[model samples]
Target: MRSIKFNIIVLLTILSLTTFAQTKVVSNSYSFGIILKIEKFAGRDFRYSLELKSTDTDSLKNIVIKVQQVINDDEWLDVNLAKDVTKDTVWHSLKISSKINPRAKEIWLYANFEGNGNFFVDNLKFEIKTESGDWEKFPIKNADFENNENNPLKDFRTNANIPDGSTIGLRNRTDSIGGKALLIKTTKASVIFKTNYGANKRIGKYCNINGIKIYYETYGTGEPLLLLHGNGQSIVDFNKQIPELARYYRVIAVDTRAQGKSIDNDSSKLSYDIFASDMKALLDSLNLKKVNVLGWSDGGNTGLIMAIKYPDYVGKLVVMGANLNPTENAVEKSMLNQLKKDLKKLQQKQDTESKQMTRLLLMLSTEPNINVEDLHTISAKTLVLAGEKDVIKAEHTRLIASNISGSQLIIFKKQTHMVPNENPLLFNETVLNFLKQEDVKN
Candidate 1:
């Protein structure tokens, strides 16, 4: 229950600045150190790294990084580094051992210099994380996950350690999505793990919500942000977004009931309210009272229902390509026609994957009948966003925006329903700006 500024630092004679995902010593001239204070648990893995081009790279003996644990408001005790590695004349890293003080409320990583020379550091990043909280916010520097062509498997892999004979190809979509993840911003916040996969496994869990097993993965650290997938799509639908949002928020991306890895208990029907109810239950299971909600397509419809029905549970709402009614006017006829064709092709196949795909398609073709007037009932500050060339009509998006009292509306030009994938930088920037606003009246 700490404030956003709980990470307040007291750097001594060091010029430092941090953007969305980067922290650096802007221009330090004296024999100074960059100090970062974070509210995190003890005995957790702490890793930080930065490049250095000092007045002399010939010697790093002047560099002495000291890890400290807070005792009181003003007192700190030296904590031993699990792996002290300041020996490199090149880019050095500080990998603090998992050994931490239990009474410590805040830990500080100080880059100390004692000699007469100067030390310069940039690309500074810190990670005090566990496995379940593992997330990767992909930065623009080297993000290339979206190059899939004839085969989707080329872009995605099944979770680690699938059975020897497990299915491959698009079946990777259903198998499970797990691997070493990263989160990169202007300056990459990297966790270089020499540890094995046991320590690197992304935290994936299943919780019983609304009498069904809801599967989800959480990553990064900050205000809780919920990501809901589209109809017939899995949490992997947000493969591009998770890395983008994890840069600032603790992202909880879920596979809604009856879709993706979630189970429906043999129920053939799924509704927005039911999905919304499951989301509420998920919050309860996670012990989180309120979270920011970002939903796309059918998930967006569910977000509207959640905001309207369970106002207290939603802090902010961002819905993209959502429709009040599942009709031709509300949604594009071309999209419906394509879904019909895709469903028909799936229905003709007898494979299990085809059956599952067809089931989800059927759900999308129908359901979601909202009253545009009911949009006024949403108490959470809402952001109704849609692509200029969205499957959901532009006027319909405007209607949703106009109805929500103080909602912000943005229609991205030259984009379709898949703006999150097609134009991620724009989509992420808009969402981050809206989420970061501190004075929005609900």
Candidate 2:
């Protein structure tokens, strides 16, 4: 009986220690922020700038600070926030030039820390550019962090619920600029800013393609360049490439049928051929004679079909992480297995959403059965790309490129199928270089 009682005590002690460890980890992770009221300067073009300093320069690599100019409760403006702060133990000036909404009622700022770090911020300044080409300071309360005399954290706010001690905290401290500064400290936490890409009315538009509406966004104006996203994704997937590509070409980013804002009510099974047909119809509606095409994954398959069936519509083609078939010879066995498992689960459900998902999965598993010899029919100058670790087999990608006469193939090293999203700068550069090349007449 004594031995059993000792064992129970040891088990209880171990559980207690485990609980304490978990609490300690949770306490170390938190997020904090502050809201500054600035409503007087609505409907004006202005430049927002701030000075920030970090104790550890390495930690700055993971910290995120987002500034939003809120307009009338729901409307908001995203400022191209400062991301070049690469210095430590010294102040760095971050500036952004953007126009404010005419109906803006308030502006808020939030800072998120990914790991244990401390940062100091001061001199939050906003300057409006006058019509006469002059800069004037807008009236802002506590523009500098030197007003908190009685309260060390008068205008500050944090997630720290404790009155005295917490993982996340705010306080006033003296800085090298000979003034008080707001000190924000956090142990660890994560915060992601929700971005609206597929639904941005600023650039989004729709055109009737067949019986369904196809949503697309256009930017810049040199030559039309169509961007097609992967399966189950929309314009949001190409958000990183659109703006940069827009600088050089007329970027036309489209939401494939049944995805994003292009809602489909038809109960038919999805196929790359149907998707390619929709693309051709969309280009026709836009009055585009011939345009360059950039496609990812499933979009790549659609592009291939478009080039095969409607060669006159495609000029230069770039396809990344695409495959000719749905079998293990094209895609990794593990990916095929996972897709089959997911499709099985979705098939058991009867909801509208589940049915839609089932269709997408079915298409991924059994469609795009392109014959390698069919690629020989493609006359468009093509650049085939895939990541070294992509779900699509490397040899399959090479086979597609080899079959297409005079095509170029590149495999991104140390990258997966998500290279376009994971390292967009490199991906965009490679794409731009290829697209800007002098075309050889077929």
Candidate 3:
């Protein structure tokens, strides 16, 4: 019976010690600014720490310091009130034991003055003790929650308006390839070559064929070179290489369907055939019988399709990060999540039609029909460029190069899916070299 009683007491003592160890407090004494208000805060949990340093009883009676919690704009909670004790210098420590609401966005410690008499407060601090879980900071700033005249969200959302075909303004500004702007104004003595072409309003003068508008911005005077952007990007994705490539060839950068200023129609019905047909239409519209093609990612896939389906229109094909197989499960899941988030936001803003279009585009982007067997049919002089870390595995790239008759393969060291964008200098140099080599061979 005695052992049982002793065990119960020991358990109680352990519980008490555990509770005490969870909270800590410290105090400091320093003077600054107004006497009626506390100037400097030094230690933690000062809200619970009370100090009285006075021998004269009359002077102490008029002093009062209250600690309050600012809950919101109009609400406050008074949690501490210090009492005077007889001493020239006195230090008091208090431990705070309270439950805090997990959902409360912000908590502020405020010192409230009661009487007009000068009251000095020094070394004030408050630390919240929580047993719940680790706190995660939200990305939204304090200014985002404010709806007044100085609110930043009003201007933020206004500037975030990314139209279908025009450039998508980067949120975090950088001079990187993905963020560079495309120069679109016409120059003097520009050659006008017009043909029967349906213009897509979104991507400014790019031709639409078989319900897909291929984005193409042209410059310089030479053999035509069709440029294709990678996934999740538009013509703007090739901004860095445009000026240089344009100097040598009549470079035409295209934003494939569902990416950058291009229309997102029935994405579910999308395939390389649709993209190839669109390119054929674009070529037919421009009255160009044949052209060199440079494609990145999905554009590479489209280029392969064009070479296979309409070999007459392709002069030389340079394909980068092109995948013969469908995207893997992990890649598909990540892509779907991003698409879902975008769709949700669009739906919330009453963009019902755009939501469906985006969904269709995602479905098309992940279609599993295209494979290595289909690539064997390509007859164009192909130069397969694969980034070292490209989403398309090395074996697949090798297979693509092997299957395509007399195709050359070049692997860019230490590169990824955005190799063209990430390493523009190397990408351009390699392509120019390959084209020159093909020229010699032909």
Best model per TM-score: 2
Q: Candidates 1 and 2: which is better by TM-score?
A: 2
- Which lDDT values do the candidates have, in the order given? 0.63, 0.73, 0.52
Ten contiguous residues minimizing lDDT sum, candidate 2? 16-25
> Per-residue lDDT of 86-195 in model 1, one digit per residue for the tens?
54444344444444565676655544332223344433455556658773221222112222323322322112222222222211111133221121111211222121
Distance (Å) between predicted and true CA of 380, model 2? 0.3
Instruction: Pick the winner on lDDT between candidates 1 and 2.
Output: 2
**Candidate 2 lDDT by residue in tens digits, 35-103:** 445566666677767677776434323444445665433234654454544656677776777776666
Total clashing pairs for each candidate: 6, 0, 6
TM-scores, all candidates, are 0.54, 0.60, 0.50
Candidate 3 residues lying further than 4 Å off, grouped into runs, are: 1-204, 208-215, 263-268, 327-357, 438-442
Candidate 1: clashing pairs of residues = 82-97, 136-182, 136-183, 137-182, 137-183, 137-184
> Tens digit of lDDT per residue, candidate 3, span 134-243?
32221222211222333322322211122222221112112232222111111111112221111323324657665665566566679899988755556766765776
Q: How high a TM-score does candidate 2 get?
A: 0.60
